[model samples]
Target: MAPNLSQAIERIDAAHSEDPTKVDIDGEPTPYELIYAKKMSKFLELHTPNPDPLLATAARAQHFRRWEVPRDSYPRTKPGYFAWRTFLKKRQADQVRQLCLDCNYSEAEADKVAALVAKEDLKKGEGKGDADAQIIEDVACLVFLDDQFDEFEKGHDEEKIIGILQKTWVKMGKRGQDLALQMDLSDRAKELVGKALAG
Candidate 1:
């Protein structure tokens, strides 16, 4: 990685390290967002042959300070959910953009990372965005599926789990789907994914 990109990722990790939520990682209590950021970077590395620096930075900062914007802060209704998500995308993008600038990245480069974080380059449906944007989306979906799906499904009804899996499946391209199939998911998760696909 270039020096600026390395510095950018370091800065993002520093921000992630402040998340108050903790998760057990190999018996060590680690900040949840820091683990999440690392997972994003790992998934992106697997999905893309050679990931761009801006895209890598965007991946690392995808959920930057996400705990500060709790979902419960908004109403539980669908419109409220959309509003919250929209706000988060904009807020994360703007903050990460400024961080990139602080790392000496050019305005255009920083803006590209912000756009990736905001998902502005995506169109509705799979394979409908620019390569970089689509890869970023894929990386995110991959991380969620690989790292969060097991626990996430435990909290929802089967119908809800299947519904969420279906929605997540559509967001991925062929490469992502292929990688997902190869993941070492638990048997239950595989069954849920099968049901989601069959539905």
Candidate 2:
């Protein structure tokens, strides 16, 4: 079973104790600060210098914030969701690319990683499936996109990036359509699509 909030908090507290000065709460020690500090420390220890501390923190916060929000509260409008997802994807891709480069991966290898990360398999099957598999796929795709984007910037073909994005959008959009087709979602989905098309 997964650890509850209390257990997770305790673990974070213990990790924070290793670097008391890093912990902060309203300018003093706080649980949030402790967790951040420990996370940064662990990241630095395990990974080479590529994913900047600030970037990693920002990406992590953005990713988790989405998870924290109730599913029902997710933005249903096309433009709204599109913009939000774009922001997240860009950040995730950038971070993963940096990590791949730092690890001495070649440009081709990195692009492959980014393509894998940008995949939209999560939009399938009522959004229900193997949790671990989904997580692995997400990470892989993100890393692939990150690497690919980096390569594109360094004189690689822009068309390749565009093609990848186009294909990914189609796949993701199809899944969205599938989700919208569910008996329970037809009305809301139609409304969202109408709004999206109008916008």
Candidate of highest TM-score:
1
TM-score to native of every candidate shown = 0.95, 0.28
What lDDT does the true structure give each of the candidates? 0.89, 0.40
lDDT of 2 by residue, 86-145 (tens): 665565445444544444545554444343334323447466643322433333233333
Q: Which candidate leads the pack in lDDT?
A: 1
Model 1: per-residue Cα lDDT over 8-87, one tens digit each: 98889999999999999899999999999999988988988568788788889998888899999999999999999999
Candidate 1 ranges with C-alpha deviation above 4 Å: 1-3, 125-127
Per-residue error (Å), model 2, residue 56: 14
Residue pairs with clashing backbones, model 1? none
TM-score of 1: 0.95
